[model samples]
Target: MRKAGWNPIWKWLAIIAMIFLLAPLAIALLNGPGGSSGLYPSPNAYETISNASRSITRLPFDYDTSDDVEMLKEYVESNREALSEIDKALTQQSRVPLDYTVPLDELLNASGTVRLPMRLLIVQARVAELEENPGAAADVYAKMSVLSPKLATGGLLVHVMIASAYETMALEKLIELTPRLSAVEKKRVLSVLTTNARKPIDFDLVRERESDYCKHEHGTVRGSILLWSGSALVDQQVDRAIETDDELLRLRDEAIDLLGS
Candidate 1:
């Protein structure tokens, strides 16, 4: 459903007054929602990616002391069990949308499973493998990234997964995929990038990416971010800095252009 708004002229004027005002939206509906490389794998692909990553030749016997490999193993095995069911849920075997299809709760049925620390490192190793060999990685991380969001314990894992997706070209094809991410998830992604990743991508870039991908779609993750970015300070200043109310209006109009239903 689209959000109600004033007619274009009024909307544009407000936007001009506060260009950053629309930054809260999560989706733009125009040209967003793809990762770039065009590789949108199906649910089956995801299973294949996750499974193949753990070839008999490259298995992590155990993680650090902070991790419990037994629990991790149980979780992985549980997820694998869901794979057969997930394969049936696919609208397309090669590119099934997995935003909600993968059952995190069902996958976590084991009392012996480790929640994240252990899986995070395992996910990282899989991502590295994806970076080196996409075909194998495709059989490994591409689908794994899609599913990781469901399994992600917090922002750190999400950030690592997103980064790994990009570094590995696993998600190079789709643009607007925050299904695994939340507003909080995005903030975390930004924080981690700002603090750790050698090349940090800021929140603004993330917003821009959503805006770019969505191209003005209503109710999408990108639109939600813009509508609720809550950047009053920045938005207010942007509103006042305009040389003229008319220019302000133009800027507002541009932002509003993104506020479609």
Candidate 2:
């Protein structure tokens, strides 16, 4: 018997395999590079904030108790310079450009460093209240309201979650403080609340940035494939985050109305 010629079906199978293999590459090419668009504000404030966060003194004590108030006062006073830098960083118009392409440890370190400052802000606010400085306390809460959103701006989902927590803390403080604030301070605080409620976290941008980081870290073709496969899960997460944010905003609106009243 003559040797069988190469099978036509085998040829067609090889062609299909090639198409399947090249599909990702074609998709990646069309999509272009991953990572941040570099449109973020210049002179990134991340380093300043991170450095300040590290320098803050951490005191382990119940913030609620009057006994800890003195310690909290000392903590704030001790970290005065650091807190000042942080305040400047947060208040500046510049963006906190978080380099998402960094290693996981580095990213975690960056995210972790910020919490101390946040905690310190709470302490400072408490001290302000204890000192009968409602205006000062109001300022602290307002700063927190501003700072909370900044924490997640241009950051990943982790940052978004952290920001949400910060915002929650700020909102809670606002609710408690609104009754005590002077009319002028209440109006100012109300303005901040309105601004934050109007512009909730941009989960879609977070998703896009995260997708870009994945593509950058794990070659475009593989990353695109991974992101595409995981898109549904990511979207679900985004939806949940948006819902949570909406509820937070609703609570904020109620607070605004109460303050306005």
Candidate 3:
């Protein structure tokens, strides 16, 4: 009689164990694989950017004084070929292409590398401004403004945030330089800002890519359990990020309008 009672208990324990084991599997299966099947942008610009990122030397000081400008000029001359390639790439397309299938580490590495060129551009703009060529400075800022949007497109949240930062930096520089720019240069800069403001970053796509990244990271059973359990919180955080991006873009547009006026 004791053995019979023990058998039911063992069976119940087995059922509970199975439920624990299979629940994550079931959740993962139901969610299906994340990632998009849509066509991505051409990799040419991204390839160029990656190549350019390799040749850059980190600048230690801000591009403020004549000495700083000279340092920037030296950096620019040293990375001239790479910077040229980046400029050519920028003219070709308005979006930075990334292989979403790459590992998280690779994407993070890319995030770090891509910012070098933006820094280089800022240096170049400052050099021009200090040289008393406000038109050239405005041109560099315009390119920075345009490239900022491109970097955010078809990227993860980190990329979007980086782009947003660059955009703000470029806008501030342009605003400071606007009074010095010729009427034609001001109009051109205003036009670029207007166009970029109109095409806001697509947070929907960013959310999807983020989910895909999580799926990629948590493919194992143990990982899946953690992911499945924490997905609600992850999604909530992502939504909050999206809202933040929306507000930032709105303010950016308002700033652009002020630039135009």
Q: Which candidate has the highest TM-score of all?
A: 2
Clashes of each: 58, 0, 0
Least well predicted 10-residue stretch by lDDT in candidate 2: 91-100
Q: Model 1, stretches more than 4 Å misplaced?
A: 1-47, 51-62, 66-261
Deviation from native of the Cα of residue 91 in model 1, angstroms: 25
lDDT of 3 at 61: 66
* lDDT (10s digit) by residue, model 3, range 128-197: 8777898788778877777776766667778777777777777667767777777787787777666644
TM-scores across all candidates? 0.23, 0.83, 0.77
User: lDDT at 228 for candidate 3?
Assistant: 72
Ranking by TM-score: 2, 3, 1
Superposition TM-score, candidate 1 onto the true structure: 0.23
lDDT of each: 0.35, 0.75, 0.70
Q: Between which residue pairs do clashes occur in model 3?
A: none
For model 1, how does the per-residue alpha-carbon lDDT over 1-261 read when each residue is reduced to its tens digit?
999978999988888867566643422333344344234544443344344333323234553232543454444454553444333322223321223222434322321122232243344434434344322322332333334322221112223333333332323211122233344534433332223212222334334433333333343554446545755754453344322223323432332222210
**In model 3, what is the error at residue 153, expressed in angstroms?**
1.9
Indicate the worst ten consecutive residues by lDDT in candidate 1.
Answer: 149-158
What does candidate 2's lDDT look like per residue over 1-261, in tens digits?
Answer: 898787999999999999999987788788745645566654455666777877876655686455466777887889899888876776454444666568767776677667877788888888988888877887787777677767677778877777788777777777887888889888887776666444777776787778777777777878788888998998888888888788778767767887899
